[model samples]
Target: MTSIPDPVEGPGASPAVPGAPPPQLVRSPLSDGEWHRLHPLTPLLRGGLFLIVVIGIVFANLRDRLVFIFLPWLAPDIEDEVGEWEGAGGDPIDFIIANNLYVLAGLAVLAALIVLVAVFYTSWRFHTFRITDDDVEVRSGILFRTQRRAPLDRVQGVNLTRPMIARLLGMAKLEVVGAGADANVKLEYLSTANAEAVRADILRLASGRRLSAAGPAGALAPPRAGRVATLSQTVGREITGLIEGPEAPVTELESVVHIPVGRLVASHILSMSTLGLLFAIVAIVIGVSQGVTWLLFGFVPAIIGFGAYWVRSIVRSLRYAIAPTPDGVRITFGLFTTITEIVPPGRVHAVEVTQPIMWRPAGWWTVRINRLTGRSAADGSTDQFTTALPVGTAADVERVLRLLQPGLPDDERALVVQEGMFGPGETDTFTNTPRRAWWIRPLSYRRNGFRLTPDALLMRRGIVWRKLVILPLARLQSIGLYQGPLDRASRVTNVRAHVVAGPVSPFLAAVDRDSALALFDGVARGSVRAAFTDRTHRWAQEETSAPEPADLVRGAESAPAGASESAASGTGEDRT
Candidate 1:
């Protein structure tokens, strides 16, 4: 560990020279001006040479079979050889097959090996990466040379992924998830140790330090006080577990919450992915065993597709964890494609917690969020919103909730949050969907509702997978009201809240038309009030002083008595 160096008055202590280069946070991994190539194994790890070889071999086999079967037309001379074999009392088909098989196999193997070697060599020769003070650059491609650069400052976070094979070989891929869609840089197949070091170096550079103005010591400003623990510390704890006990508690440095592997597996089993995979497997097994070859055509593709999706989902979420950092909240997870995402301070737009009916008994919930960062290969495309936590207990949920919504009112925080999630219409100040909405969604109409808090907008929907979205009013971007033909006939409207790039933002579905407008008005008013309000994202900096519950109770009590009574009359009983 590098200790904090004592104060020293040196060249760096004085203001930088008029034209001198900026002080580097650390030495660049590359030479000042040299173009460095990637690890020699990059081609095998990332190049499509294996795919090319497989296709080449398949085509070779097909060509050999066609030539043997159609020799009479394809090569009229071969017909004479077949006729000679029949004249010598050997079957023509047998003669041709026996003589051609071995030669074709040898030629196919030779051709495949040659093509694989050429492609792999060409890819390796062209691929290179370079690190500089301001950016990390990667250049690759044989036919169409391409270069990608991620500026150190624009780099949001770094992801280090080790697939099962790569992990066994001590190799990993490092990705810098940049601020722009095209700026992201991926360094494929570096030694694991080098990847981790590069990640730390990149983060330190991106953190941007300055000399402390407070003290004569003039120490360099360190990175975030609560930065996520490094990969080495996290891996050390896993290794320590074998000697310590089964499932050693996460170290204080690693994370505040650790999703148990058992919970993760069980949650996955209960998900739609597992169901789809099971259906595909059953169909494929029955199709192949029953000799219904046509069924194979339909089920084979589904089986492969769903099986891949299932495996990737599980790989991407293994060892999921959320840790605090000065830059923002750091999320690290994945078994194979390990991803590290930093939700920078004040960047979160909204948060959603959902509990499926099956998980309700286990008290497990999945959390997701909306933030401002652009799409990333590590984070995934913009459409697939990353899960903050796939499965967590109510307490775990509360911890993450507080982390994401630091400005949440302190008093009755748990009660208020619970009310938002799976609470009845009367819980807190929630405005229930009118009974008339039953026509649109009979199973979950009563469950749809909204609650406007001083700091956030809470909306809940769904019956089977209860979804509760908490949109911090201060982060509200825009609000809209939609009325379909059915909604119009039913006198209902869907109110949607818009945030930056993410899965669909929070929405109140199928509420009474008048109530929807009123809700929209409330949201508009709340957004106006929250505009320009400086909210802190650091969890530690939030105010935690407890006030009387009455202070929060007032929010619920302030809900219009008439609306509450109207909802009460509709439900045939008061919900509270």
Candidate 2:
């Protein structure tokens, strides 16, 4: 291969030298290697209890048989006595109860101790993890020997989960959520402080900060020690600056917003899941009264568990706040194992602001984003990193909008973005579902709407849970139009924007059929324009100024297709 001379480094050169071949990265070995073993208690904490329980159960079932067969031989004293019993009663259980009971108990205890020590020791010896500047790697398994690695840049998020026992012991498990599905790296049972420090390092590295593995025993240095000061120091410096006005230190990051604990608690209590809990309670009562009292045992435990989970989840999200950092947005929250994650700029793919019907009265909205990251949140409904704002006011929504896409024209927000989130009726800048749609979606028809802006296609829907999905034209992967039999009868079509896979693909339903066709054509054309004009996803990262979307149609080009007349005709109005 003809090797070209190294090109002068420019805007986006590879970190490694271009002309020279990249250095090969190798995994640390198993024994006498740089790889670090998990906390000594990890095996016991993870599986030792279960093994003990299993062994106890087996011992309980086989005690009499074991005593009958081995007791006489192992204990010569029992041999003479059991030989006498062979004449009195040949029953194994009788022998176990009379002569060999203590012996059996002793044997069981000894066997359990042996198995527990053997299993836990082996497990502890096998699991190992290594942190290099470029990647986090974990090697596990006794027989199969599985090794998994996640590159520092590809790590989307890191979760430090401390289970009930783990928390009590002040230990935690670190899960590095990666961009690729196969790149999950988990380091279980690190000291709580160590886990937190490791998580910070991962995020710091992912945010493009350099980390030196030349520290003690090849461990990455504490992220805050020298690279970045600890949170307390940062805050203290800010306070010190404010007091010494003349010598106020320059602040690198600004705290933009913080969610109140009271609001978080209330919003979680009134969440859509509250309705589900009520229904569950009602079902339990009805079922029990109807001679299905047996169901109470299962249903009650499940209901309690679900409620507890939600409560913890709510508490975890409490004290949620967003701040601007050099790398991107800094998200910090959590009741116990507080998390601090840096979402690098330009990574967000889609955005959704929604409010449940009950919550609308309270002026609360939840903001979530779709990023090019790992799987959806724990519930599997949305991306794990989706919820930027679990609950907030209109102003909060605006703040988030400004942060995500600052380049959007100012007129666009006033003309559509704000109103599209919680507006009523159609305007020159917005289009709503036809009146005929009310017959099919009686409660939500008035709220279903779409607005086209220079940069994004915004869709709003729902009465109980209001939703605004913002899909940037440049990020669109495909556009689709669908009409079922009922939609055809109602003379409406659904327009779906297929974006990158995560949570926030935008879909607008019950739009007038004629308008839908026109909207689809406009979006397809807009995407082509956006591809050339806007190359960067992050507004701040744009190198070249592309032409702004100058003449985006505010609404669909065509009007509703005789929607009122069709409703009056009542041919298929009540089909739904």
> What are the lDDT scores of the predictions, listed in order?
0.62, 0.63
**Candidate 1 weakest ten by summed lDDT:** 567-576
Cα lDDT of model 2 by residue, 346-414, tens digit: 566678888887787789888888775554435352333567888888888787777776657777866
Considering only N, C-alpha and C atoms within 3 Å, which residue pairs clash in candidate 1? none
Error of model 1, residue 21, in angstroms: 8.3
Where does model 1 exceed 4 Å of error? 1-24, 27-37, 48-145, 151-156, 180-183, 205-252, 271-312, 371-385, 412-416, 436-438, 473-475, 484-492, 512-576
In the range 1-576, model 1's lDDT, one tens digit per residue, is 233222122313222323221334333333222345555567666656567677788778556445646564777566665556556756544555667665776687789878977988777766776555567777777777787888766665566656655554446777787666556688887755556656655665455543231112222333423324543544564444323421212223476677877877788788776777787778778888999788788777877887687677776676677877655666766654455555555567778888888888888988888764545545545433357777888778888877777778666467555676758745446677778768777887777888777778778788898888888776776667888888888888888777655653576778778877676656654554454344333222333465544443344246564443222211111110
Candidate 2 Cα outliers beyond 4 Å, as residue runs? 1-34, 48-97, 101-111, 131-134, 163-171, 191-257, 271-306, 337-341, 372-385, 403-417, 425-428, 434-443, 485-491, 500-505, 513-518, 525-576
